[model samples]
Target: MLFGIILAYVSVGSVLIPLVLASFNWQNRSFEIRGLSILLLTSLICDASSMLLSRYHINTMPIVNFYLFAQFVILYLLFMRKLEIKNFLRVLLVLFCILCLIDISVFQGPYVLDTFSHIVGNLILMALSLYYFYTLLKELPTTYIHRLPFVWISFAALAYYSGNFFLFLLNNYLLKEAGSIAWMLHNGLNITKNVFFAIALWQAYHNRKLST
Candidate 1:
């Protein structure tokens, strides 16, 4: 838990720096930057809340639940808009939300973390990230691949989610059996995710500057 907290602070820095940068250039805020800003802010709050609740020996599942669902929506919007798959993705998002609600209400209560949703949602996100990469490859020239914000974000999402998929799948079991190891792994992966987001945001900032 201590390790998790420390990593959370570092991750928050990754998000916070870009957020501060974006704030100063309000006139140049692109949709991707705005979406990332919202995601990073929400993640910071959720991480802090989860840590505080854990410190108090309170149930932190609700915060986890909210973050998982909200992150999916935010990322979905980011990718859907970028991919121009809004109509189809919107339907899928709504259905996924309903299914998730049902799963939470029936199988997974608010007091307990929902690994099922995490696994399924992460799989979908990973697929979306891959699709984004495919689109980027097909649409962008080789020279521009490294500079595109989507490239960094997609790679980050793919790497983070793929690495954590099984960990999240077994989170509840591990939290009880190997609590220390569980938190360490979770926090470490999260830090990676945040760093990647920071990189993507920085690239977006540069992209915006070039456009202006």
Candidate 2:
């Protein structure tokens, strides 16, 4: 419990650097950098709000649901610029929203935490991350992969979604149990994503200096 608490605290605080870096270079050419910054801010707000609400014995289910759609939209916009499949993504976005509404409104109710949306969202993001990787391999845009912001951000998405996919899958079941350890991995991966996002921001900053 102490360790989990520590991790949770770290996880919440971890986004500051990346979020600052992202905002520092807000007018960036790459949508990925700007999108990631927005995503991190969204995450910080949601996580911090959820924690505060939970402390007050308030239901945080609404926040969880909102964050689900928010990240999806953010990622969709990011991909809309990066990928060549805007039309398909538009249809997919509409369909996904419709399905999630049904999943929340009728099937599970808004207060109950639903895993179906989580499962599906992670899969969609993971697939998109993989496709981004495929483009990287095909295009070979930069010789120094370490300095590529997009590459780092893409991998960060892949790592976060893939690492937590199963955790979200099992969340409904494990959540019912007392003292479940599933959250450890969730917090750990959250930290990993934050660190990676900061690295991506640094790479973008470094690339900016190089160009200037």
Candidate 3:
């Protein structure tokens, strides 16, 4: 818990740096970078809220649900820019939203985390990240992808989503058996994710500077 709290605070700092950089480099505020900034801000707020609500023994699943939905939207917007299959992504996003609503209202109660929504959303995000990579390679054969801000951002999302895929699937069992260690692992992975986000954001700032 303490570890999670500390990491959450660090994550806030990671988000703030990019946000500040974006504000100063207004000319370089591309759609992708702006979406990332908003996503990070939302994540930070949701995480902080979850932590505080948990401390007070309040249910935080609704906040998690909001985060899950926001993540899908933000990631979709991020990838749609370069993906050729824009129609497919749009349909997927619609279905994703509908399913989340149904899951919350019919399948899962508001007080508990919606495991189905989390799983589906994470899988879609992972797939989109992979698709982004595919398109990047196909479209920019001569351009070095390593220098692209969106590439780093996609890589970070891919890594984080892929790493946590199974953990979320087995969350209930893990929490039941090894609650302490499970939370520690969750927080640790989250911290790693935040570090990657910071890197991606910094890369965005640097790339924008180069372009200008």
After superposing candidate 1 on the true structure, give the runs of residues whose Cα lies further than 4 Å from its correct spot: 1-5, 8-14, 169-176
Model 3, span 88-159: residue lDDT tens? 888888888889889989999677778888888789889989988887767775456666777777877787
Question: Against the unseen true structure, what C-alpha lDDT does each candidate score?
Answer: 0.77, 0.83, 0.75
The C-alpha local distance difference test score for the whole of candidate 3 amounts to 0.75
Model 2 C-alpha lDDT per residue in residues 97-169, reported as the tens digit of each score: 8889899988987786667876788898899889988888898888888998877777777898898786765
**Model 3 spans with C-alpha error above 4 angstroms:** 1-14, 172-176
Indicate the worst ten consecutive residues by lDDT in candidate 1.
169-178
List candidate 2 segments past 4 Å from native: 27-30, 170-179
Cα lDDT of candidate 2 equals 0.83
Give the C-alpha lDDT of model 1: 0.77
Q: List the residue pairs that clash in candidate 1.
A: none
TM-score per prediction, in order, is 0.86, 0.91, 0.86
For 70-124, candidate 1 gives per-residue lDDT tens digits of 9888888888888867788889888888888888999977887777777888898
